[model samples]
Target: MNGLEKKQDQRRRFLRTLYDATGGRRLTFILAPDIGTKLGLTQEEYTSTTDYLVGRGWMKWETLEGKASITPAGVDEAERLIAADAPQPERRNIPAPVIAEISRAFDATYTHAQIDNIFMEASAPGAPPEGSKLRKVAAWLHRINADSEVDALDIFGRLVREFLARPRWGTDLDPHAAEAYDEEDSRFLDALAAHGLSYHDGKIFGAGLLAPSKTLAELIRARDLTAIGKEFERAADKIASKSLGPLWKVVQRHLGIAPTPELDEDLKRVLGGLASIVAGVGAFRTHAGDAHGRGPGAPSIEPRHTRLAVHAAHTVVTFILETWKGSK
Candidate 1:
């Protein structure tokens, strides 16, 4: 083949590999070895191809430790290839029963709050729950007074398989499967496993046991602020033993807000106060008088201090979000 043909072939192969990577978690960091093994390329070939792509500014890489990640450009290229080569089938004509079954499965797996949130986002503006696609199927069953028929079951099964195979909505299955397994197949399996769903022979069977969708998972994950606060506190305590400056620097990084010299000094004072409060609390608790009203000094568990710390964290997050929005 000519040089042009060889480059085209390499691009096509890279695109195919990237499409496979999308099958679970839509956008994610993938290691070089995994990509190489998945694409049926030797380590050398994979490295060369990736390097060439990156050099051309079609892809980017980030290395932490020895692992490398494909940049956003790589993902977009892969998606574009899939769109060009394997367009998704139209689902508008799909039977109502199939939609109902899938919707029911989603309901069973997710909490009421989660379901409501998803429906709200997916539904058209001001539409009733029953007007939403998922809820529409559920409503159809109620109106017809019948369960999903065999044809509906088949359609649902096919749709499930297809859904599982797609990137941005599915999961990656066995990364160690055959050297040239279908990317879609791997993604479906990966998604099922990631969400704690059961799969057998490339079919989803127990979606009822899986956690909520990725969007819901993100919300739930972010809600664990108490644990996050404790972690910050621990880190702050460690840094306090050394110097408050380091901890203040970390806070700035986390909040994505640059600190002026004045801000830095103010942050140091806050950290010092926090450290003193923690120390004072420990000391008082350890050497308290017998009566509750006869403590050595004021109580260390000041609601105002806790509230301030929490407020600071919230303000930082808000400032970061505002900055991000403004830039966009």
Candidate 2:
């Protein structure tokens, strides 16, 4: 090659070598002799090249006692030069099989909303600064899609288990441990612990998992669906019994329920079920002792039985929601 070409090549090689040495670490020191030996150049050539780099505004030098250290700008130039010559490959689209595995694993332990939020956080940059676990999971998913050989479910399951088992790194009461926690972090250290589930951390340290508040919220919301379903059933019952009929009737009239055959059929079914329940209760009262054997008073409802009935209704509503809405 020509002298100009050779000079350019030398500069490129020098920058690439510097970039490789730094990797992800901050602050690298290079002695003149070491650079000379690596580049197979004499001490004078090394000194001249170093001067050339400084002249080009790519590097600056500092002397501390006898050793020389490169400035931050020098590191940046090295990285930039290396990156310009060897650009990183574009991130590949995540494969369908990997997405399926993630979906299955998430669904088994968490609600649809939780999984959805987790992905949303993963897709959005700066959305979950505190959720290292979520970041890990997103990384793993990307790796799995890239070329990871392990089973996605097993890997993801291991990660989830680990997340459940470990005390969150930041929440430890020890002063040294607490120092690691970022301020305004919303992620919890113990989520499933509040719900009575436990796991081990050692088995899943390498598995990518994220434990952002979004994921936790999704899980909690799924649990709340059961409560909401119960409330809905109780409200339905009260309305059917005319206890809250006026309110429901007003809603029905406003919504033009009578004009829709499907609405009419559903309403009929609800009223019929209530009538059957009342009839059954009345039949039981008739079989009990009358004025001669019992005191003159109305039949008393058992609070425990009412509570159990409410629970059963709630469970039924929850089942319907799960089957139809595919949530909770």
Candidate 3:
């Protein structure tokens, strides 16, 4: 290049050497001919550049022996040049399946607005580029993991731990009760299957509660009280007629009650309560669950109400299954 451009380049190298050696905080020897040789500059060129920087207050010599340090302004200039020469971070493309899974987990737990806020925080001091909230958050997650900022599994694990810690049903119960209370639909259904009332191809016989229970779960997820209540009524009917009828035969033989259509008084009362529970769940759904249309003053249905219905269903189903198993 031209002489002037070449001189500017040499000055940059000198400042960079000083910045690297001491970050501009301590003096470095600048007089050695080998120093200029290492920088690909002749002694004359090095001396000329050093004098130019000193005159501009960009560097100062501490002694005649040439111990020198870069000035604050010189350090700033060096940093700017370094940044200008640095490569930009490469944009990474996240796969659709990975993004879909991430979005599903977060959507299940967070409100739309809350999720937006989370994405904003994760990419803070700068907002994510224009896209759907899911896409933006997914991209940020991918970028952070690629950069070694944090592992994606660690983030997911934290979310799971937080969800487990929170009282999803809004109750303050002991861990044992809560564990039984929060029986997932799949787990509860599996328990019923082992007791000879298995679900298959979306249909289940004997108990007949299986299909409706599955429907109830979906409705609950959607926060559909009216549909949930109607399904609960159907499930209760199945529990009373289909589920109990078969189980009662076994109970009669076990209790030494004669094989007859009529149940003895004591056993009748106990079994009747089971039917009553089913009826109660259905009734709760009818009145409070919004199964039927309401007046303007009708009470609002909350998540706790749905949770209560599900928990009651679990109790009935579990008791019946365990009873049947015990009798066998």
Candidate 4:
């Protein structure tokens, strides 16, 4: 085919993939890399095709980040083309990688019996026959996704948070899961309160900071990687705002700078660096978190990564609080 023909083919495939993923009813974000791999397109081809569609107002995407969603126009176009073509087979089964990721997460925290209990609670009619918990659970997930209206992955995610909220333990649940992390979190809050900053309705009043740190703690406990990265990014944005914006005045006072209407370039650079570090947490979330749809090829985020993110947030917030208090 000629250049224009190849380009059109790629565009059609891209739009079709997005439509299939979401039934064109919802705007679902898909990673650019996944689209490229699935379509067997070169980097240049992917870039050119994405830009063309986005320019034509057929989709919304940040080419730099590779997170994209088809717009209504794009959906209409895809639908038109689909109707002109022969009917395609419906996709029923959940991707194997997705199923494996869910299974690993469940197995790590729940024993075979607990798995059975969760499955029973979450599954609709026609639960799988009793047998190997691992094999049976996997089989049931495939069956349900193929046969039921509800998406299998969504059911598993809901099941996780529900069971995790109750007091319980599995054979493999981390013994150290209940370690002094809460104490550290409490101390951080106490330190803020000591500085006369009170938290209410998810914000620290005096600092004018959106503090979702507590939410992060709960997500960490639940081991919900999907939520953890997104929450971390949110908390990081708030901290970064304080570090880089008007709060910089307070920081300057603490730095012993004379009252001046103008910002000192040198000090700004230093603060900017700190703010960037804070923002990096959010960046991490965009890449690794389930705030957006992750492709099956994306590596599963681990418990250690969540712990690291939480600790990093704690450290940054602690530093900011200490600086603000010292300025008083």
Best by TM-score: 3
Compose the digit string of candidate 3's lDDT tens values, residues 186-297: 4534443554343322222233334547754554465546643564465555444545444444444443433244767777677666656677676676677544866677
lDDT of 2 by residue, 66-88 (tens): 23444566677776775686866
- 47-69: candidate 4 lDDT, tens digit per residue: 88888888988878745677788
RMSD of each: 23.9, 25.8, 22.8, 18.9
* lDDT, model 1, position 200: 31
Query: What range of 10 consecutive residues in model 3 has the weakest lDDT sum?
Result: 198-207
- Where model 3 places Cα greater than 4 Å from the true spot, the runs are 1-9, 19-34, 61-69, 75-96, 117-328
| Each prediction's TM-score versus the true structure | 0.23, 0.25, 0.34, 0.27
Best by lDDT: 4
Best first by lDDT, ranked: 4, 3, 1, 2
Error of 1 at 87 (Å): 5.5
Candidates 1 and 4, the one with greater lDDT: 4
Q: How many residue pairs clash in each candidate?
A: 6, 6, 0, 0
Candidate 2 deviant stretches above 4 angstroms: 22-27, 64-66, 87-328
Question: What C-alpha lDDT values do all the predictions have?
Answer: 0.50, 0.47, 0.57, 0.61
TM-score: the better of candidates 3 and 4:
3
TM-score ranking of the models: 3, 4, 2, 1
TM-score of 3: 0.34
Query: After best superposition, candidate 4 residue 285: deviation in angstroms?
Result: 14
